[model samples]
Target: MARQVISPGWKVVIGSGIGISFGAAPIFTSGFALLTSAMAHEYGWNQTEVAQAATIVLSATMIAYLFCAWPLDRLGSRRFAATSIALFAISLVVLSQVGPSLSQFYLAAALFGFVGAGTNVVSYAKAISRWFDRKRGLALGLAASAQAGGSFIVPLAAHGIITRYGWSAALLSFAAFEIVVCLPLVAWLVKDSPPADASVPDSGSRPQIAEPEVAEADIGAAEIVRSATFWKLALCFAAIGMSFYAIAPNTMYILTRRGDVTAADVAWIQAIGAIAALFGRILVGLLLDRLHARVVGILTVLLMATSMLINGTATGVATMAAASILMGFAIGGEADLMPYLAGRYFGTRSVSKVFSWLLFAFCIGAAAGPVAFVRLSTLSDSVVTPLLLLSALQIVPVALFLSLGRYRTAPEPAFNLAAAPS
Candidate 1:
């Protein structure tokens, strides 16, 4: 692909998008599950409650993201995200002050979940998709990888901080970190569209100007809502949320079941997994640009299935490490692909709103994953088996993606920057 026209404004969008991805990642992912032993030990909470809270957090996130979707496009990504970021920072601090009460913990988790829901990869993906098409997947992937990078940094940092400092101190530090990291960047650069995005270039020397495109008929969203592509993508993405979040929230839980896996080994596995995700995200981003989105998606899903199978059949320390890394590959790829595919099919006009709705579907899957896994595991007294079954569930998304190949995005003429803007 030719070098992407990354003007100064576009660069800022990518940076802020990365911040959004990173700051938003830690709240709902395996962070709690990884730190479960430390949290439970400190707060004197039971296993069931702790596990249940993970589900609640995902549930809260699902609902919040749904609520934020269309409003975000209308309210503006920057404004919507700003409020959510503030909520996340404050929630973390308040959560640290939480006592042993289940209700309090649940409330904290809900706030955290809600904040995370509003500020996520979808927003970042939409912002980038508006600016670049040729390299859209790569840009989206790199921004998406910020979340994976956060998954790496936050857990390790939390583990060390909680081990050294108390949970309250560590949490205060976490909140402070989010405020410092997300606020200034988002406030500065998170615009809804590029200056040229909504305008057309004039033929010769006519000066160009930014204008929000208006379509005739003002097509009611309900009409778009009823399309076959919509439901297929929604269901597929939701399935993705299920399989991915299930593993994310349960990695440490599954590891803890065994007595011999050392902290050093777990740390190494997690670090390796995080590192792998960065590459995986970048690879999918690159691939999505050059290759067929759904074909690449199918391959990535298969790779993820293999990873899940490895996770299911785990015996000792080595297999666990490999599984974590393999699973990371899937998470990273899908993280990149979802938004890229959205752009490939839907275009930038309503990308944020579309992705927001898709993410709501994703949230439903995400919420069900960890909580259901925990519940079923408790009921059946089996962890690995229940999780392994989720692999089969992922196949449905692969089929849905295949069906999606027929849905093509409009060929919006690329903004020829050298030409006069109109």
Candidate 2:
């Protein structure tokens, strides 16, 4: 029997991609960055304070990642994703009501973070893992690319809305879009994996299909906590996360303030970054399928470091856009590579929890990065110092990933294609 070139299961990848693309966009750092200037001007808040609100949002998401992982494992992803989108929309609406009081802004941010995990990569990864075993990397690459897809467009649109209507209106518009667009797409299309008893199409030759070697014993959360690999992964992610958070919140502001770029110009540059990120996810996904993830991870980080150096010395649009592309690639690589590593090393059985722990570490760094950049930039009176530091920090993850042990490939199992369902 000739195996189907495309599995019906690819729908899961598409659905999850759409879900994450639309759902994660508005609450994402890029979206928040669009509001930063407006909020600061209207409320007399500093850049640091605006970024602190973003930190709170991420911090809340981090906490949610910890508690929700187990529940997700037990309850399945469909309802959680749907409900989270709903709650996320509500959070946006509430945030749109922010006044001069900084306390209210923080409170809304905390709420957004609390409900934000459902729309995160963690939730979608769980669903995608169940669908494809051999083509997991590409599937995840396609799904994770949705983030960049959304980031590409959301910031541009949000900036336009903020410039014309007001920040409050921009928030309200995003909330409405989330409800009208993402909610229905997720509800109608997204679902958990098909039943194990079902005949799923595995990519292979007509005579034989390679079945993945399933582990007999599932890895538990406690074992992961005790392992040296886990700590290293966590620490590496934390550093990268901090760098991302710091840069994302400041990208437009830095360009506008230092490079003399206007909001419209910044919007177009950000869209280019999003495109770079989209390609990065696709490239990383393809590379992970063929090469050891550690090798790919190291190379990707080095590329990011190069971008950071460019960004630090950027003098105009040409240089800044080049830097943004590199930054986007780095961000996209992190999103795809980490989850792929978790599934490969830890076993899909515990990927949700394992990746969540890693995400928590990332959040800690993310929370710290913005504040640190703000302080450092304030003290130095230039953004270049902070950019260079972030570039330097990429080396930490590169070193850690480089030191990782080679993956112990499972023995491939022989299959009788006639006996198996096509």
- Per TM-score, the best of the predicted structures is 2
* lDDT digits (tens) for residues 1-422 of candidate 2: 77555554676677778778866543476677768677888889988888788788889988888887877888777777878889988998999998999999999989988887788778878777766666678888888888888888888888888889998998898888878988888777667776555445344433222233254357877887888887888998998888888877777657875677887887788889888989999888888778888888888888788988887888799888998888888778887877888877776777788888888899898888777888898999988898888888887999899878755333122354447667
Q: Tell me how far candidate 2 lies from the true structure as C-alpha RMSD in angstroms.
A: 3.1
lDDT of residue 227 for candidate 1: 70
Assess the local accuracy of residue 71 in candidate 1 as a C-alpha lDDT between 0 and 100. Answer: 68
Candidate 1 is scored at a TM of 0.88
Kindly give the stretch of ten consecutive residues in candidate 1 with the minimal lDDT sum.
199-208
Clashes of 2: 0
| Tens-digit lDDT track of model 1 for 71-169 | 676777677777777778888888788887889888988887887776677656655665555556666777777777777776677667877886677
| Candidate 1 residue 334 C-alpha distance from true site, Å | 2.5
lDDT value, residue 392 of candidate 2: 87
